[model samples]
Target: MRDVLGKLGAFAGALLAVAGVIAVASFVIGLLSGRVSFGGLLVAVVGAALIAGVARLGKVPSLLGGYSALVYLGLFLPIVIVVIYAFNSGRYVTVWGGFSTASFSRALHDDAITSSILRSFRIGLTTSIVSTLLGTAAALALARARAGVRTPAEVVILLTVVVPEVVIAIATLIFFVNVGFELGTTTMFLGHCVFNVSLVTLIVRARFLSMGDSLEEASRDLGAGPISTFWQVTLPRLAPAILAGGLLAFTFSFDDVVISNFTSGAGHETWPLHILSALRFGLTPTLNAAATLMIGVTLVGLALAALALRIGSRQGAADFSTSTT
Candidate 1:
């Protein structure tokens, strides 16, 4: 009887969730179609309430189901707003004069904007790859090193995160000047690498620490060479963390304004820099379109990274627990 009740409660919750999703989808569709109504929103709210009530019946603790619904809505609301505004046919960014694709068309056709976007992409991709490699190696080295050596290295790695980004930018600028190097995409790539490497290191290090050394040691004991063990055993386990860190680095590089400002040369503006410059003259619908695209890309990258980390960390924990048992 208890099992049947629990199953029924969960099924009821699932049905409510489906209804809420349908209602939300209808509301979004209404926005795009210029037919937004209060009815869809009311249905969504009622569905959410029913879902939460069902969750309570199913033994979920602390109103977690309700909190989860709210949290997801909060996170996605801004994106939806930006997307809706991106299609605005107005000269101003925020005003909803009408629905049109002119903003996207204008943004896509602008050579300066497109070029800056391409440059940012190149810098971001290169930085992500290089930083991930360097950071992952450093993390592995630290994990395998003696405590005395690891302590100082860990401190150095963390200092970049603790220091102000402007300080790092200034230092990078001065260093480049001292070395007689010109500021450009190369300089921007290098500057981004400095910060991103630290970020990757932190993420990969946590993954490494959680994974522990048991599997690696076992591989070696079973007559595998260190290179082989790392390639076959360690790399596979670390793949998700590396990918997550790389995506994070790419996102950071793409969104950067302050550091890129110091490192970018004359006539070599990144997308963020371009957007900032445009904002000086007040925001436009075209700018909103560009920003909306950027936000979409960034959110996708972050979502993927978060999913990778979550899955990888959970799998690692399960493996470790099973091994110990």
Candidate 2:
């Protein structure tokens, strides 16, 4: 009976996938002809959902792959559009003129854009540094702390990350205003640090927990002092996690718009804020170029962070194996 049901579900999933592909193709063709195909889009969406449901029920790998591809297309299509349009020679963002790098050149030469980009970079760098230092210290303390103390600390850290950014932005704004602190780069820096510190702490703590204390214990047993053991043993092993956390913090800080909007004072527009302001008039290919550049930087940061974490994990495994031997 189970085999019969699975076969039936797989057949249904296959039919739905075929329908979805046809609908999607029709929608794309309509889009290219400047026609809105809501019916086709609706059909595609419904088909995709049905196929996914059937795949889940039947354990059909092909159906699941089809659904995942559709989902990825929806998510990345806009990014693809933006990147393609960055090379557009036309003044407007949506219209396709001939392909050229003029937009990038213009964006680079624009003083306001350049200044905003630099300001964001500076803020992100500062935020990452502060967050990494404070977070690493907190993680170390938590590792040694009693459960009663560590539990609350962990909850607070998680709250900082999980709380709505809009709420954090509004609250930070209110606090700064109430205290008579001027909103500008300083406030933005501080606001970014508030949450970024939590991100770093969580990452470092996870790495530290997985690392265990065997190496540190061995160092201590070898007649090394507390500080010596930390510098020679713990610090070296913790470095990759620290670097990963810092990169992640920097990416978040650079991409932050909600917190930056609330905290940035007059004349201190970050790159995102600058883009927002430019939207009042109209979007240009230059903005697309700027966005593409930002996207590239963000991707690079995230990639580096992942690489660092991977390296750290391997190092930890090697260290553990050696210690055991």
Best by TM-score: 2
Candidate 2's residue-wise lDDT over 114-224, tens digit each?
999999999999999999999999988888789999999989888988999999999999999999999999999999998989988888988999999998889999999
lDDT of 1 by residue, 105-127 (tens): 88889888899999999999999
TM-score of each: 0.72, 0.78
| Residue pairs clashing, model 2 | none
Local distance difference test scores for all models = 0.84, 0.86
Clashes of 2: 0
Cα displacement (angstroms), candidate 1, residue 12, comes to 23
Q: Which ranges of candidate 1 are over 4 A from the true structure?
A: 1-76, 298-325
